[model samples]
Target: MQRPAYLHASYRYGFWWLALVALGLLALGLGLRDPWPADEPRFALNSLEMLKTGHFWLPHRGGELYPDKPPIFMWATAASIAITGSVRLGFLLPSLIAALGTLALVTDLTNRLYGRRIALLSGIALLSTVQFALQAKTAQIDMLVTLWITLGAYGLMRHALLGPARGWWYLGCAAMGLGIITKGVGFLPLLMLPAWALLAWRGKATPLRLKELGLGLALILGVAALWVVPMALITTFGDEPGMAAYRDNILFKQTGKRLATAWHHVKPWHYYIVSVLPWAWLPLVLGLPWVVPSWWHRLRRLDARVLLPLSGTLLVVVFFSLSPGKRGVYMLPTSPLLVLAMAPLLPGLLCKRGLHWLATGLLALLGAIFLVAGVLGAAGLPALTELAAKYDVTPWVWWMLLGVAAAGLLVWLRPRRGMLGLAAWLAVFWALWSTFGYQQLDQTRSPRDMMQRVVQITGPSAWLAQPDFDEEFLLQAQQPSVHFGFHTDQDAQFLRAFDWLTQAPGERWMLIPQRKEDQIACADLSQVNDLGLQNNEHWWLIPGTAFASCQGDASAAPLFVAPTTVADAATAGYQPATQQDQDGVTATPEDSGK
Candidate 1:
């Protein structure tokens, strides 16, 4: 069958229009929100610290050496912050540009292989996929890593097919090297393995000479060495012993430990196949089940298009599964190939009766979900209060129902436009969610409001000590807080830090979480003000005048007697009120939104 005329002719040019839509989707909420935790504030704070300390190679979190990641992504983020002068805007640019560049590369690659129409569609598929868009707007390294991996894949494809000989190999290997620095396992040659296997099967692997392969490997090592060499020199020979942790983490823990015995984000072996990929690459995977037979047939015949993506995707899934440390986003580098694998089946899917029914059912299901959410949000139901408490989303979030209804109508009236309609529908929801939902989400996630109250009460230069400190709160407050200790471990470091807090030059204000107030043995303490719940954790501002438990300071000087118990502590302007609405537990006066 001849390809559609529109696929060949219309898409031959003006494909960049799709890139604009992607940019808009990615940039919608880039600067409107403060960095939230779990990843954002960690990286953002690290970058901001780097900017302040002029230590570009070493990454720090809350003044402690943080070495879970390489510095290239943070360097880019720091540069962005430097240029933009806003942390929110600064940290988001690298991912946004990487996503846009990936889309451009995908379009070009698809155009070469499957014609311009499929190329454009693949780009659109990538843009609207929930995980891709979500990661692109985040301050994380996944999107940047994916960008390098995609470029490397493109280079490998060029070498296998229409390459200018050795340059393609060098280009691909160099890109992968950059990926390695961006993320620890960016060196996974998922693209190269499949491309090589297919070429070897067809007796066309001679284009990749052994001499060129060695050179490419050398280039990759050299590019990666740019940072690793300097970093190794500093950490090995520097005065800071804490940097040994950083060096060990970067060289071993970040990659090897994560693969073998991950300290965090561990999951079952089948997590990727059973949980992650099915939804992470959605819209592309929407009709995938119905098209698998066609893919299977193509694969059985050794079709390069199907084989390339199949082998690459299989290798990545297996490699990640072998590692106990699994995250959904870890599969992001293979997402472009997943999109590519599905792009060729679009025409078949458009005609498949099963797909038509499945798509319509999905559209109806989406409409129903939005309809219920809108009804609940508009009616101001109690059930939505929990969601609202967490997301801080407004009644305006339900406005997406209107867009959903419009999309349903479009699908009903013009069934042939179902795919485009579905893409538009998802795009509209994501945009609305990002724009309106993010506004409230930001307010709730941000500590700027609560930190401002602290500043107002204590003054800017007041000696502030947070034993169980939150980096996000500290970053947002822009306060160089005195770190007493961490909640997780109470080692000698904690004792020394606690002693420092107790014996500091002047009186200190301890910002203790209300739950931990009973744990501190401090005297002459008084309540200042309640800084409302952040991430559902309630904190109280307690001013400590005397250290009750200093190791050797029982008879040093006469300041005040330390309290023996929580009952002995004094409270000023303290009123405890329990409101059972925000969090599942009984909310304290802190729930007053103070």
Candidate 2:
């Protein structure tokens, strides 16, 4: 009972091109829509400042030195700001463009190497990958970084396998360099495919001409230097040594020492292995036996092209496995490499009637998961929505996701339609992110808004101290001039001694705010204030003597007394400080300012 041989070759290729285009659009939409965590907005704001000030060096966030990472992500956003006149969208565009571009590249390259049906399945798999799609819209540089890395690896592999082509070499050089600029260091992992291609084949190394190699290398270095040299010059002279420290620690430490620098970047070795399940899902587990069987057969026969992609994927996975610090994104570039490696065989796995049931089952599981995403969105986001009322559109996005998941379940249940089921599910999942989730980003206040709130609370004369960093993060919202901690709030020298006292000589107003568990910094504000309220993560405002008069009783007796920097003249103009104001906390200025 042999099935017709035509089934393998007869996959409808014409619509897959359209599918790729749809995926690209979906990716772009996803990227543009989700602002996600504060980190992404912070990147966007920094880049916006770079564009506005025309100064690429100093990232004056919240009106101070913003020292962290090379400004590659910022530089990227500057281009978007120029075109769109909106920093928000500009910040997200790189990831969106990178994601969609990667899809097109995968479809085009894999189709050329494998077949139309393979191209379709690979494109759907990579693009629809639940986590991957979500990450594309995030503000982080990882998505674009992965795109360049994938391209670089693919290009280098092509040159190695097909003999040295001038274009392939040049593209390899350029893509690798862009990959470096995106995240700094670790570019070698991205080149794993090409390296594996060379290593898997036992013959003499295919040599590139010194002239061409040098030329390509120069182009790569030139593009990288465009961003790096400026950062070096500025950090050498900036008030903050943070950027300089990062440069020395990350670029110089190369791999190990810097892993200890930040918690967000820190994790156990098995972190990636634990995370691979969500990214690869059930299909990877099901396809494992088939993958190795083919691999063992091909390797015994010494097939360079077949070995190249597999080796590349393995190299990256094994390399990241050894890193002390492993975030989910560390293996991002590996996604395309692995997808491309398995592309030729994966479709056959999907096409099989018995084996294909696993794919359907996986789709059903995803449907159940997304159905939960819908419920959580409707249930969980209201608290965030109540606090962040501007995100009115966010709740609908969740419901829409649920609806799409329901639709996907219908598509997935049909007979022999795994490919189409993948597309429908991805569409609904991403569609929720693009139109509904993206709208929530606008609810946040920029540095400008934050500064205004601080000003409205404290008078012009009060010193606005930052107990943590330079307070650059808050300033990136594009607010007017708010003095640095030294000028507006308590200077560093007085922050420790009797900070919560009603009045301290040079201290104008205490703005020390408390923080959450996952905050980047830690401070014991016990000496500063018993202020019952908190901010971003830590540090409470120290109440000065003057606040008591301001907080007496709001209804004519006096609203509430507020702590002040100087006991002499009380600041005026706003309603008296009270324990129960619009923000819903029951801490009057007197309660925590001590």
lDDT of 2: 0.54
Q: Please list the residue runs of candidate 1 whose C-alpha ends up more than 4 Å from where it truly belongs after superposition.
A: 1-9, 204-207, 390-415, 484-488, 491-498, 504-506, 521-528, 546-594
Best by TM-score: 1
Candidate 1 has an lDDT of: 0.68
How do the predictions measure up, each by TM-score?
Answer: 0.86, 0.70
State the lDDT of candidate 2 residue by residue for 459-502, as single tens digits. Answer: 54555534333332233211122232322233332333223322
- What lDDT tens digits, residue by residue, belong to model 1 across residues 1-594? 444333444664558688777777788776566677778877777776676666778887666677788988889987886675445557788989998888888788888878877777778778878788888878789999989888887787666655544676678789889998888676766445756765656865435666777887788889889889899999999996477777987999888877899988889999998998877877777777776788889877766666666677778889899998889988988788777777777666656555545655666667777777776767777787676766555753456565466456665645544565666677777777666767667768877677767867777667666665676665655233655323234334334444555665255666767776545544344444577677768777765444445442223221211111001100111111122321234333234222
Model 1: pairs clashing at backbone N, Cα or C within 3 Å: none
